[model samples]
Target: MEQLTFSSAQEILGFLDSALGRDLLLVPVWMRNLAYRLACLQEPDNTALLRRAASDLQFVGPDWNDTAHQLLRSAEALEAARRDGGLGH
Candidate 1:
């Protein structure tokens, strides 16, 4: 595979908007550090994406995955409540 590089936050942000960006959090330390730096910029849109990435930090085991799903649901429920909208959590 060809090496992927980002010389600026814009490049990284663009990548994050792509399909491959779904694996952003699973990347190596250097890439995670880059994401952290990007998140620190406090852009609302990117912040939400960062939050979604954080939510994906869960165990792969079935039992653990269930708990993780519930945890993510709780967060979503809270956000929906804040917005006065929920599919019924």
Candidate 2:
């Protein structure tokens, strides 16, 4: 199956929110990272950081037929997030 591209965190959030709103048990990567970071500060364990990194490190951008296009979109998000200081580990 082909993957889809998302432009912004807002786009990702919107897609996931819509896709998962019908399912209450769904946990988005962003929310999970927020929780993981909070947990790490309280507990400060290796496991917490590992969990957070594993969840937050991956990119979920659009999936174009051209892998380069897909990767570029993902890179754009990462770069934007990095510049805006939106990316947190």
Per-model TM against the reference: 0.32, 0.28
Candidates' C-alpha lDDT? 0.47, 0.44
**Candidate number of the best lDDT:** 1
Q: Against the true structure, what is every candidate's RMSD?
A: 8.0, 13.8
lDDT of 2 by residue, 3-59 (tens): 223133344345445765786346664554454334344433333243333434343
Candidate 2 positional error at 22, Å: 13
Tens digit of per-residue lDDT, candidate 1, span 47-87 = 35445544444422344455445545655656677678533
Candidate 1: global Cα-lDDT? Answer: 0.47
For model 2, state the Cα shift of residue 70 in Å: 24
- Distance from true position, residue 55, model 1, in Å? 4.4
